[model samples]
Each structure stands twice: as C-alpha cells, then as structure tokens.
Target: MPLDVESLRSHFPSLASGIAHFDGPGGTQTPRVVGQAIADTLTGPLSIRGSSVASERNADQAVLSFRSAMADFLNADPSGIVYGRSATQLTYDFAKHLSTGWGPDDEVVVTRLDHDCNVRPWVQAAERRG
Candidate 1:
C-alpha cells in the first residue's frame, strides 16, 4: 500500500506545528518513535546492566532491529548498509577503504554539484592516501 501522508505526519511530533520544512535536502525531521528509541538505548535498563549476558543480548537485538528497519526502508541488503553521521562521512570512510585498492596513478572523479561535506572528505582522503 502507498504511504498514508496523514498517518505518517501524525507519527512525527515536529509536524504538529505545521512548520514549513524546506530543509529536507539537508536533513529531515525525525519521528517521535525515533526520539524515544534513542532515549531507550541510552537510558533504559538494558543500558545500565554491566556486561551481563542479558544486556549483551539486548544490545545485539537493538542493532539487529535498527539494521532490519533500515534495510526495509532502503530496499537494500542489511549487510551492505553502513550507519554513519552523514552520507558525506560515510562516503569518505568508504573512499579511504577503497583507495587502499588503488595506486598512485589511479584517479578519483568528483563533481562540483555535490555538497561540500561530500566533496571535501573524499578530496582529503585521496590527498592523504596519495
């Protein structure tokens, strides 16, 4: 089924204000569930347990849950999905790893249309590796 816009809007607390959200290209507002999940991860009972087997299990479950949700949303292989602070950072990190397979004569093509966050990191990585 197609996503119900009204229902999806209801899930996001920030949308209640009817604010103009033109900043989506940079970052979109997160839903209430995302905020609560983060709180639970940081402050819930599972986080308080000191190296207990149950705590480890809970942490593992949390990671698996996050991965599954991301895979579902992106229609991607969960193993191929990497979590990072931003797409720019992730691409830079990937470039560093990939650069190891390249040599001094190899060239990396980057475009000016990209955001500085995306461009600068890869440029820095290429320079450092070279």
Candidate 2:
C-alpha cells in the first residue's frame, strides 16, 4: 500500500506555509500535536523529581512516562535513556563519560559533516584526556 502523504502532512501545522522543511542538526518542524503535548506538559502540575509528596510524585510520574516513551521509540531500555537539555549537552556528557580511559594511542575522530555542537565537545574531551 502507498503511504498517505496528505494524511501525514495534515498533522503538521507548518505545512500550511507551503514550505517543505528538511533541516537537520537541529530537528525539522514538529507536528502540531507534539508541540501541543510539550505545552501541556509544561503547563501541568510539575515539581522536582521525587516520590515523597504529591507534586514530587507527579514529577516522578512524568519522568517515568518520558523514559518509557523514549524507550519504546528508540527500542532501548528505559533505564538507559538519559535526557539532556540539548543535543550539544548530551554529546558533551557522553564524550566526557567515554573519554575517561583515553591514553596517548587513543584518538577521537569527528567528521567534517558533523555539526559544530557535535564536534566541539568531543574535541574538548579528547584534549582533556590526552
């Protein structure tokens, strides 16, 4: 069966603008439902993560739901899902963790096609470890 292009396009509010976005590095235009979901989460009952109180429990539930959803999307374990504020931050954190045992013979290779955000952190981590 052929994909329903019109049906899929309907969910993206940006489609009305007559521009087909193919941006990368940062994500492309998101669907209206996804944006609305983010707005709803931010507007809902929220607090620091914990289980001792109602607000905290609410926060904990949100975290759990996030991990579960991401795990399902990525086909990975929920416990392994680590959320960061940005892609750059996530890359930096991962590089720091991975570079701990690096020595003289070790090298980190970053491609020219990579975004600066992806390249800079790994370079810094390699320098620190070297």
Over the stretch 1-130, how does candidate 1's per-residue lDDT look in tens digits? 9989999788777778888574333346678887887888867546432346776667666767777889999998888766656777787788788778777787777787766666777787778778
TM-score per model over all chains: 0.61, 0.78
Top model number, lDDT: 2
TM-score of 2: 0.78
Top candidate (TM-score): 2
lDDT of 2 by residue, 58-123 (tens): 778878898899999999999998766788899888889989989978988889777788899999
Candidate 2: which pairs clash?
A: none
lDDT score of residue 30 within candidate 2:
79
lDDT of 1 at 109: 78
Q: Give the range where candidate 2 is weakest over 10 consecutive residues by summed lDDT.
A: 21-30
